[model samples]
Target: MGEQKVKTLAGDELKAIKEAGSGKKKSRKTTSGQIYISSSYNNTIITITDDKGNVLTWGSSGMVGFRGSKKSTPFAAQRTMEEMLKAMKGIGITEVDIFIKGIGTGRESAVRALNGSGIKVRMIQDRTPIPHGGVRKKKPRRV
Candidate 1:
């Protein structure tokens, strides 16, 4: 019977790993940004982006461990927004323009959570698309 020897990293390998991590720069601080919340029937997704539309971070009810119907609930949306707020605070975001889309149970609650968290909402826009008159209806079929 033979015993297998465990391999360990040498000093150079360890130093390389440490230096690689340390070389990365910290994220830039942003004070004004936009929050895009899409609350569909199945899930609520919240994304924080810079003024120019560069995404900073995002959170979703499903990503937070909510499943099935629960992901569309207000509570799950609130939790998702809470997670987003925590991430926003790290980058010094204090003001936001909120763009909301979709029809879901979480719509109002997500907005409320963001407001209650002390982040100044400059504007709230509903970006949901409303369909205009389109193609003509099909002819009635005989039963």
Candidate 2:
């Protein structure tokens, strides 16, 4: 009979997996990276990526133990950033270009947290979607 497939991961693949304390163990060294902050009405998610946008690690308010309405608060976002900051430093990221989205309360706080963490912010760009007139309304219901 043919050999069954093995579930084992190679050393490199194993290292790619997120660690409990530091998020990820970067295989290559990098000093500058991109920070993507997705602040929705319900929660804030921060993702760290390489210069080419390859995701290195991410953290969310929910993962930081925020619940219900607390997840949407700026404080939760700050906490989320604290978690991500540890991973960022472990991966040797010193500078970042931040891209923010959504109108949630965590939007500005997430950015400020990164800025105040001693990491140089190279740029802050708002990538929020602004509908250009948006889609047409549906026709009125027939009588």
Candidate 3:
């Protein structure tokens, strides 16, 4: 029988594989990165993506602290940010462009907490759009 051949990953390939698995993306033209902060009714998610839209260090508020109500607090959001910043510190991420969504209390707390956590927030852009007008519907007929 002929010998079988196997493929191997080069250093670049290995790094790419690692980055892919890490869920974080790196930028090309710019060294600065961005972080996406979102809060839903029950949880908050922090997606740390570079300028290229690759998520670097991400965390969820629902996954930490005690189970139940504790997870829904603003503190949970802070903890989630802590985890994200800790991960970013490993990758030498010092500054981030923040994009915040939702009206949860956690929104402000999370950003404020980041100040003491060693991560510099260069900008905070609220992506929430306000509806300019009411929805269209047929007028009700009188009986």
Candidate 4:
């Protein structure tokens, strides 16, 4: 009763492990003016809300087939926006306040695609805030 067996993850066993961990109960309700857009190091997410700012619909780069390598591409973001817009159209949203949060190519392309699809963006703000630095340090002598 000394040595314990080690588990290995590869191929289908790995896939099964991954799939088993996916999904959670959607704990929030979708309502009808809130549009939240964000892009992280891994994914891009767009959420639409009802008049009360409750999420009415939402989409992600993953949901639009922009998985893994596709997440950083402009085409991925464009597709994400298009699909998100289509979902929004079904719920009767005409205008939105775009909240962009990343420096990726998706930022601009996604907004342009939304416009081309007839969703008027009321305002565009660079939500990426720059933190303040105190001062520059003096350079040391080269040795």
Candidate 5:
């Protein structure tokens, strides 16, 4: 084998690719959307999306530089929500239906933060999954 062949696109294809990749994403006018709060034992993540599930923005305690157990604390969650709300506001999100999906210590606090942000809360739904006694119990420890 000597030289390898290089692949190239036509001028129109190249121009289309450049136009598609060069511009920043277009922001739409969204007045109401959905908020997903995922609070876990180690962290809290808040994601805001349009009604159609297109994520507008998100923030986490870890994103705010919280480390270790601090990332799971209510204060951390509140702060994370505050950061997320700032982004949401710029997107014109003034009303939301919250769907929380965890039982971490920060769960409620994060909602409170959003409520205090003056955005109308259309609904709060807990999407946490509950066990229906499916897993077998472990053997009891003996002395």
Candidate 6:
């Protein structure tokens, strides 16, 4: 009969294996980032990005378990910001510039939440689109 060999890892190797399997991989450390808050009539989404505009993480009211009309509420936006800040903090993001879009009820609350989370906001810019002249009006309907 052929001989069979069983191999086992050392204690340190087993510990490393366990640690790797625990799902706490180290994330890239970033000091400053950009926060994009899009608050529409139906939902509010917050995205964390690097200074160069590379998204690191994002969260939305819908992602935070809000549904229907609740998704657009200020409270839901606040909660979503809290969740996003918690995640961003893990990656060492302490300062940010806020860019806001849309005109939903959650807009201001989300900004307040971000500030309250201990992140230093450098600037807040409104990116909501405004029509300069808008499209041409439709022609009169025939009688």
Local distance difference test values of all predictions, in order: 0.94, 0.91, 0.78, 0.75, 0.92, 0.92
> On residues 1-143, what C-alpha lDDT tens digit does candidate 2 reach at each position?
99999798888777767454575654766899999999999999999999998898999999999889999999999999989999998889999999999999999888877878999988999999999989899999998
| Model 4 per-residue lDDT tens digits across residues 20-60 | 98877444433235567786667778887765676677888
lDDT of 2 at 62: 92
Tell me the TM-score of each prediction against the true structure.
0.79, 0.76, 0.69, 0.66, 0.84, 0.77
**lDDT of candidate 2 at residue 105, scale 0 to 100:** 96
- Between prediction 4 and prediction 5, the one with superior lDDT is 5
User: Per-residue lDDT tens digits of candidate 3, residues 8-30?
Assistant: 98999999988779965553333
lDDT of 1 by residue, 16-135 (tens): 989888967669798999999999999999999999999888989999999988999999999999999999999999999999999989999999999899988899999997889977
Model 6, TM vs. native? 0.77
Candidate 5 per-residue lDDT, tens place, 7-105, comes to 899999999999988868888789999999999999999999999999888889999989998999999999999999889878998889999998899
Query: How accurate locally is residue 82 in candidate 2, as Cα lDDT from 0 to 100?
Result: 87
* Candidate 1 global CA lDDT score: 0.94
RMSD of 6: 5.1
| Least well predicted 10-residue stretch by lDDT in candidate 2 | 17-26
The lDDT of model 6 is 0.92
Compared with the true structure, the alpha-carbon lDDT of candidate 4 equals 0.75
What value of lDDT does candidate 5 attain over all alpha carbons? Answer: 0.92
Write down the worst ten-residue block by lDDT for model 3. Answer: 23-32
What is the Cα-based TM-score of model 2? 0.76
* Model 5 worst lDDT window (10 residues): 20-29
Model 1 residue 75 CA deviation (Å) reads 0.9
Native RMSD of candidate 4 (Å)? 10.3
